[model samples]
Target: MELLYEEAGQPCFGLPSALATAYGGDLGFTTPCLYANFVTSIDGVVALGPEYPSSGSAISGREPADRFVMGLLRACADAVLIGAGTLRATPGHLWTPDHVCPQAAPDFAELRKKLGRAAQPQLVVVTASGDVPTEHPAVQSGATMATTANGARHLEGRLPAACTVFVAGERPVLRMTDVLAALHAHGHTTVLTEGGPHLIGSLISESLLDELFLTTSPVLAGRTDTARPGLIEGFELLPNRQAWTDLISARRRGSYLFLRYRLRSSCGLGLGLSAACRKRCPT
Candidate 1:
């Protein structure tokens, strides 16, 4: 991978110069940056599913560059966020940076230690229904489950002791602001979401996403009537005049392209800007 464009930021990792060259530079995040990563086909299909397994890898052709970027971003996050559906879709998946690219595990761990972060980024699962697979490998190992009050009842004792369930919403719908507040309280300000469309839509709709890292694969997963979702789902954005963002950087490897965008206005007045989101965030 090589740098095609960069607005200006020195993201450093402790890897050897030759190994780190593909990533452009060492990467880090602001105190409170909520970014997302996705790999979509040229035709814009993020998954090859309603039923396909590990759909993202299929769409991405298991591209090494994509994995490198994913691992790098995960290494920088304080928490890895994902929706329940994403949890169910990849049964063997673990959200850790090392899991994506084990060869770079040492570098990832070194980067985290250098950044003053935990040994591993916390895994945060968001669900309105609390329908996450309790026995799934990721769940069993433990994760922070964010859901509605009603959903909490469904998850009560199903999860392992390592897991903690927090009610992020008072109503039927889950609120992203409350979720972020809970994460922030736990010292998790830099968030990285690996979504399944609906979750991305919810975050984007609420203006809670700070940045986006997208990998555009060379192939196409042509959509059909069977609900092959795009980068965002659940709500319409461009049609609703959602806030626009600016491209901050771009890179390319093989036939794939990695791009980054910074939202003009990011979520919840950022980390330390305000303690109460309601006072500054748009309703």
Candidate 2:
């Protein structure tokens, strides 16, 4: 994959000069940062249909560049966050960077080592009902399951010992504020969410998402029905408060366009917390 637009050529991608400079280089976060990644059709449909269970793969047609980009983002994260639906949709899947792009495994591992990060980013699964597939391989491997107190009760002994269950709220509903604190407490400052729509909706509604990394696949899932979910779902941010974002970077490979947008502060959920939690946690 060649860079279409980065201005300065830098030493990256195991070469003296490489296209790695085109994409953002050396991503680091001292404070808690929440970002999301998604692949969507040019028409804005993120999922194809129920017919295609894993819609992202269908949406991107399993594009190698997309996979490489996914692996790259995963490499930079301290945790890979997803909803229970995403876990259910991606059966037998592992969130580690190498799992998605094995050819880049060494490079990804080297990047993490250079960044002083753990070998693999922790897997964080958000489930309100605790209705995750306990037998799924991803769940069996060490993961952090965030749910409500009632949900935690339902999941207590069902999950593997390797999985750490965090009860983020008293009620059955989850607040992104509490979730951020819990993750921060666990030393996950750079959080990446590969949402399943509703989760993205919740994060966006709470204004907690700091940035977004979206890949536009050159295809059309021309909305045959209302079931086709977009990049955001379950909520609307228009006609009253519209969340706006600024494009930070853009790159292309094949017909796919990779774009990064930094959500404006007015449109952001700015670490809204009580002074107590703010004092106890990293914002």
Candidate 3:
């Protein structure tokens, strides 16, 4: 079925349903994976400035398609994960709140019944310093904080009762892989990584992302050196082994284009197999 969003005498379809279909199996299960969502303009502008504006003239030039994709993606995620820095910079109701949309929110109650306990997918904050403002709405609503050893130590006495701070790394910044693994361990498998660019780049560099959902607006900021840089520096993927991604779907909404790409298997030999071959066929 095609879903559409309307604005300014224009009707735009929701993100391609095919993108959602690609993640049909084992999304919120024990898969250590994440999907990245990005909104950019046709001219390749993600935002007008360094700091995103909350509303009004700031977003006037942006297309309605971008806004629709953002809301839909959040609604579909098991849990929304953001860097502490992004939370601090722009903190509010991240995912429309569970109480606001009983039907739209993931069936935590059903999950609880199956698991024999209330299993709400946690809102995770990745922080190096554990310095998130205690009064932030997310903190108040019991968002979990994941940090490095030093970060937990720094906020040892400051975190709220509901927040779970995991010291998964010794350094100040927790590795992206470690953080995702911990989330998977906690049963939050369908993760969404909304960004501040640096975090997105880090995840891409680590090869931890399984899919990318992008909304392209029709406007162009035209400035390359804005306050907030583009989500990606360029179009090229990081070089290592052969990286493969397949375009799942695309839809036009208002003045934006929503696209999704799924990461496929990479081409490479495993270390264990290579070692066994060398031992058996050594000259």
Name the top lDDT candidate. Answer: 1
Is candidate 1 or 3 superior in lDDT?
A: 1
Misplaced by over 4 Å in model 3 are 1-32, 49-68, 97-120, 233-244, 264-283
* Tens-digit per-residue lDDT, 1-283, candidate 2: 5444432321122311221443434333324578899999988898766566778988899998899889888988899999988888887799998898897788788778876689999999998888899999988998889999888889978998898998996767898778888898888888889998889999888888887889999988887555888988888888887888877567788788988777785242465322233212111
User: Which pairs, if any, clash in model 3?
Assistant: 40-217, 41-217, 42-217, 50-227, 50-228
Each model's C-alpha lDDT? 0.82, 0.78, 0.56
Alpha-carbon error at 220 in model 1, in Å? 1.2
TM-score of 1: 0.91
Q: Order the candidates by TM-score, highest first.
A: 1, 2, 3
User: For residues 215-236, what per-residue lDDT tens digits would candidate 1 score against the true structure?
Assistant: 9999978865877889899888
Worst 10 residues of 2 by lDDT: 10-19
Model 1: lowest-lDDT 10 consecutive positions? 274-283
Clashes found in each candidate (C-alpha, N, C closer than 3 A): 5, 1, 5
* TM-score between candidate 2 and the true structure: 0.87
